[model samples]
Target: MSQLGTLEDLPIGFRQGLTATNLVPLWPNLRGALPHGIPTRRTRPLLWRYSEIRPQLMEAGRLTPIEKAERRVLVLANPGLGLENMQATPSIYIGMQLILPGETAPNHKHSPSAVRFVVEGAGGFTVVEGERCPMEPGDLILTPSGLWHEHGHTGSEPVVWMDALDLPLVFALEASYCTEGEPQNIRNEPDASQTRYRRSGLVPWSGWMRPPTNYPLVRFPWRDVKAALADLASVTPRGEAVRLAYVNPETGRECLPILGFSAVQLRPGESLALPRHSASAVMNIVDGAGVAEIDGVQLQFEQFDTIAVPTHARVRIENSSSTKPAHLFVVDDAPMQRKLGFYEILANEALPPI
Candidate 1:
């Protein structure tokens, strides 16, 4: 009766929800849509320890040269996401990439925008659309989708960096494309000339090269970023934490089109509560120790640890040390979410709209 309101109305032989039933069998099928069942995320909270993987990464370097692997990366795969090549989250893909001395990764361009957060080394550079942007530890580099890019390291030591891409979002929308190209012999060896621009307070612009919607500056140097952070550190008002968003000088928005970057610092004994929103974030522990509690799980993270926070989960962060401050660099899909108008703060007071 009443259009088969419950799944029990079906035959006993077909009790499983996936099976077809006599009167549509709605109850079991509709249980996933119940108020308590919010399915915005498929990935669980994961902590990727750098210590466990660094040795393997070093081994990978000896095994495969840049010519063989093109890009030697150790992808961060979430256990909850069962796909073999699944993204860490539904909207982001993160990996630690390595480039050995005198090695160059083959040139390739893809439709999925990508960014790199340097973790170690120097004399490494990524050539994006003819401009050679040097990579240094703590520097952020943008290689927007559809740009011809390649990475090479001339330094004596190996260079490693975290590669963050909007591959999940691109492939999900069925708009993914990639093509390999010949490597460009672009180099500005020894010293990075780009750093000089910051001291002169002059913006570098090439009239011949330009891209639509991409940030004009490919590299955001750590030297300038640290200076800004230091300037704001003392003035940070009480009850407020220090956080700085990486802004595109051209548009004054997030640097990347899909991925957003922010530096968050919590003073000693500082605690900050973050409201739940419909975007996922991967936080790279920059320095110090802290605890980040998402939903109900408490994740203790130290330097170089990466923690993933899924959408629609309430989060609270605390600097566990009484004398040391905690710093984190966060990457998320907030830029894309804001663009699609799907971003919302779903605090405890209001339920997320279905």
Candidate 2:
């Protein structure tokens, strides 16, 4: 007999033959494999106000010690993209880490990369490898993948920082691993790595002390960054914001291997034009109040408020005050996406370049 004209036309016994051989036909599922329209993601946009969560973090510090909890971080899970019911985002993992005075978050290293933006307090520091960098409000620190690091606060009050990681992607790929380092970081010298790697327009000579892929700088001091932003704000025309991307001093690459970091400033009465990209971004309001319209959703943000913009979502930023400027710190997985050939951008068709 001639072959059945189509899969559905085949007799029940013939259909069972295909399934039993582990060779099911693909012709019936071609449409789902190649859809006609752009795909939509399950992840959704959201915002978190630090003021509302600060008390909970404080309460956590009182309940758990660094040794018991290992690290006191409250994960900022994206409600829409909770994988395996763990409440993790699709691409990134964010949390507010707290370290009370006289406490030290133990040393450990993981396959996922991490970065921290200081929220408040002083005398708190991060020890990466051997060099210790004191973290103050506004400072940014890197903890690259597989790097030994720990946190401690010697100040009177608790030190809190917004922590961002690429662990969600790591978990998605099933490449997650963690290991404990020595009780203390190998090196205790303060600012040694910063002085060695972050000097102006210079890189330290290295015979055999470098890794295949790692950011050389341990800390990007807020003072110098703020000063440069202020200078740019003055010269860049009115109603324009100054944006700076943090790069590696050695190769001028991104600050982290998996993520991108940037600082943005919106001058008084400045409004950034709407633009969209393939990568989603989580923005922390460093100072000043502003309104960010993302995908037709309006978010009025104040200091310490965090707003998440989903992939390819249109965004426009506006500074609310006519006399004061707004500063924002942003983190995104653009580096990984770009490296994977899935990154695109529509950079400011309405306004001047940032």
Which candidate number maximizes lDDT?
Answer: 2
Superposed by TM-score, candidate 1 places the C-alpha of residue 78 at a distance from the truth, in angstroms, of: 0.8
Question: Residue 81 CA error for candidate 2 (Å)?
Answer: 0.7
CA lDDT, every model vs. true structure: 0.78, 0.80
Worst 10 residues of 1 by lDDT: 188-197
- How good is model 1 by TM-score? 0.83
TM-score each candidate. 0.83, 0.86
- Candidate 1: segments with Cα more than 4 A from true spot: 1-40, 185-213, 348-354
Q: Which pairs clash (backbone N, Cα, C closer than 3 Å) in model 2? A: 130-187
Q: What's the lDDT of the predicted structure labeled candidate 2? A: 0.80
Q: Write the per-residue lDDT of candidate 1 for residues 1-354, one digit (tens) a residue.
A: 233256556667767544454445446556456435466467898888888878889999999877788789999988777657558888889999999889888789999999888887888888887678888888888888888899888899989899999998889889999999887766444223354235323444642245534556778877677667667777998456588888766456787778899888778877777657788999888777888887778888888788888887777788888897777888988888999888887755432211
